[model samples]
Target: MPRKFKVTVNNVDYDVDVLEIGAGSPQAMPSYTPIAAQIAPISSVPAAAMVAAAPSAKTGPAGAGDQCAQMGGVVVNIPVKQGHSVNEGDVVVELEAMKMKVPVIADRSGQVARILVAVGDGVENGQALLTIA
Candidate 1:
């Protein structure tokens, strides 16, 4: 594709046509290119590893996991269960994101009334992770 550019140097004005390289032009694309990449066979991964990759269902108490707060990543661990007493700053859940593990701590001293998410569940940046009651 050719892009036009205008430049002024000193008192002279110039218009230039620049040719873009690579894929910007439709002609650069192959007509028969596949719509998706082909995935390799999963034989290399152990069955246990594949199973561990999945997140489990929500565990412990019912009724909207109260005091839901936003946190993003995969629930890697739930160290505190429902009815467990905790103090402010006690780790309740551990999240894994971008190859880093982050511990979700108790915001206030109270019993963990519910564990809304289970291990392996994907979380959003502002989605509720759990509640303290």
Candidate 2:
């Protein structure tokens, strides 16, 4: 047997049907199907609207020597400050994701021209962390 109930989520009301198991013999059990699969497809919906917009590429403020984050995480430490000298492969920023520390390395050897992110800041992939001149 299915019980109908009204549920509210984010101020939106939804009617749901829930079936209780073990109320009858195993042979009387009904096959389960997801609600989404049962809904009819809407051909009127535009394909572009169904797809999400991609994030835009970011560049350093100086327009060169930008060191971007490879993954999304919280900044745990900044090893280099603005005007500090750095070499290729040097760790410029450290991020913590999934309880693991990840180091952001410099791709070019130059002085740190700017630090775009600070310690305790959250960063996304491709976001500029610092720039080297």
Candidate 3:
């Protein structure tokens, strides 16, 4: 006998029939069939909309005094802006990776000189997020 199951993968839903085969049974194998009509189309959401809010300041090129990302991830928040005073170990940017939120801390105390990335931007390890001067 075949059992019907509804499965969702990557935001898409599918209806599939699954069969079971026992040892020493006459049937050599079990198969499954996915009903085309039951599948739900996957929808795309804009990256900017997925984040809490977009960065308010303009981003500039990387330069001296830049604070960098320690790991690759998507920018979730920017807690400091250009010209904002920050202290060493202060959280300046938040990143989301591997289903975890990571805080990017300031390496030195200084006024923010520049913002190099915005919320919803994907950053690589060691990439500059902002600059302290």
lDDT of each candidate versus the true structure: 0.73, 0.86, 0.84
Candidate 3 lDDT over 1-133, as tens digits, reads 9999999999999999998777878786556566865665535555667574644323345467888888889999999888899999999999999999999988899999888889999987777888899
TM-score of 2: 0.63
lDDT of 2: 0.86
Number of backbone clashes in candidate 3: 0
Q: Model 1 off-target regions past 4 Å?
A: 1-71
Which residue pairs overlap in candidate 1's backbone?
55-120
Q: Best-fitting candidate, measured by TM-score?
A: 2
Model 1 CA lDDT for position 70? 41
**Model 2 regions lying over 4 Å from their true place:** 1-24, 27-31, 34-47, 50-52, 56-62
Residue lDDT tens for model 1, 8-127: 999899999987767677868657745444554688688999999975434333234353324567888888888888888888888888898988767788888766788998876555
Q: RMSD in angstroms, candidate 3? A: 12.0
RMSD of 1: 12.4
**Residue range 1-133, candidate 2, lDDT tens digits:** 8999999999999999997667666856668999998876878667786665555545534356888888989999998989999999999999999999999988999999888887998888888888899
What TM-score does candidate 1 get on C-alpha atoms?
A: 0.49
